[model samples]
Target: MNETEQRRATQLLQLARNGDAESLETLLASYIGYLKVLSHSQLDPRVRGRLSASDLVQESLLEAHRDFTKFAGTTTAEFTGWLRKILVNNAARAVETHLLAAKRDYRREYSLDLLRQAADESHARLNSMTAVHRRGPASEAEHQEDLTVLSNAIEKLSTEYREVIVLRHVEGLTFADIAIRMNRSAGASRMLWMRAIEKLREAMSNENHE
Candidate 1:
């Protein structure tokens, strides 16, 4: 997010926290793309086909809306973190419903902790790629804005570029694995990934300038 966007978000957050229903709706709507990306990255592969990221994100957003009054944090990062927790929880439930419906020891197969850790790892990787650091302690709002910016940039890429980026970065797949998944040679996968990164960087650069 840029300065103008950040200021707007802060204003919306304050209004939402103070019981403005329309402001709350607007605030949550702004995060739909970011939430969708997080939901897609954190969803378990076993249940990817069974559950769509949009559905998971919608569920989470509804829950967030219902519980917005309970949220006490004052920064965008805290709000984003709260929403991510909801997304992870919903994703874990989806995984269990689809992948462990018949298993008696389903708990052994999956845990919310594992999903949360995966989300954290993905967040760290994305932050490393897109974050611009300053000398002093960076504010939480700045970190959250970086994520929002990156998510929007990713959403603007071509489908093939987006797929390669999610596979290589979000999923942490090796080039060989991505090659197999994408039905290309390892060298070809690497090339595609390079192109995807270049495009992504350009998109992010344009976003920052805007």
Candidate 2:
């Protein structure tokens, strides 16, 4: 992060720790986009209509705010990890609540462990998109920043483009699977995937320039 970002993060962290709700909200806002992408990528496809990614992230953030006093972590990494755990747990609960209550018979149920595994796999794929050669704390920080940039870029994409890219990369779905999920032919899904990659590259370039 830049010096300004670091200073803002520090100030927000301190204020949030002191029971400042607005500060906590501001801190969480910085990550809302990232969390949305994670939630979308990991959400059970069968239950997506009933569970929105934004809603899930909001619910998780609310829980985090309510239990702020219980958090012991002081660093940015620690904070991210803590929030990720909450998001994963909330997602798992959401799937169970919506799927079972709705009485929909799916091929599988989303256990907490499975949710976490999916999140980890998606995060790994996200990290792979911004691969760096070095290995150290500095490299890790750069990687995280790159991910944030990429996430923002993805968020800027059109829904169709974003959906295709996320399914193809983050969820590791094949063209046939994505086609079925998107209600498109496999050839059309491949075409959309290509377009999405082109758009993603353009978005990243624009972000870099800005």
Candidate 3:
């Protein structure tokens, strides 16, 4: 965390702890995007419809706002990790409360057709990415393909892996930054990233074969 961020975080925590409502809201608003992305990545594909991501995000924000007291000794990694925990926990609760009460939807079938389509979409996205996304810039057609591949790859990642990847890679936090947000040592963050990459490679390979 930078000096400014550290100060702001400290201030927010203190305010929230003291029951300063607006300050708490401001603090949680700053982190809402990260929460939404985490929730999306964690959702099971088998489920669909009426799953309110925004509501879950709002709920998390409210809880954090109220319980900021418990979140003392703040570090950048711990902030992200705590946010992640809230999102994952909320998702599990949502599934149990909504989906489990009803019959299994079974609408999303995992089959050759869906897999091939996913692979094709992923390859296209990869080919289309800009200079930074897929190693380097590409021609217009390639750029579009790169985006398609990237999107598919992101969706294919497991929730846990996706959380780290989004924060560190997509959100552009450094390894140290990621470690702090994830509440892990730098070594663990590095290993998690390595594992995420390995999973991506496996996903890509499977796409190619299919």
Which model, 2 or 3, shows the larger TM-score?
2
What does candidate 1's lDDT look like per residue over 124-196, in tens digits? 7677655543345546656666667788788789988988888877778899999998899999999999999
Q: Give the clash count for model 2.
A: 0
Expressed as tens digits, the lDDT of each residue in 46-147 for candidate 2 is 667888888888899888888888989886667777888899988777777778566655426566777788888888887777764236444434555566
As a TM-score, model 1 comes out at: 0.84
Candidate 3: where are CA atoms >4 Å away? Answer: 1-7, 45-48, 102-210
lDDT of 3 by residue, 1-210 (tens): 233333355466567667787766765665664455445534543443657556778888877766767775554435645665666666666666666657454324323244334333433323332244456555543443333344456557887687676666545568898888778988999999899978866765554344
Whole-model lDDT values for every prediction = 0.80, 0.78, 0.57
Over all chains combined, what TM-score does candidate 2 have? Answer: 0.79
The whole-model C-alpha lDDT of candidate 2 against the native structure comes to 0.78
* Best candidate (score: TM-score): 1
Worst 10 residues of 2 by lDDT: 132-141
Q: Poorest 10 consecutive residues of model 1 by lDDT? A: 129-138
Candidate 3 global TM-score: 0.43
Cα deviation of 72, candidate 3, in Å: 4.1
Q: lDDT for model 1, on a 0 to 1 scale?
A: 0.80
* Number of colliding residue pairs in each model: 0, 0, 25
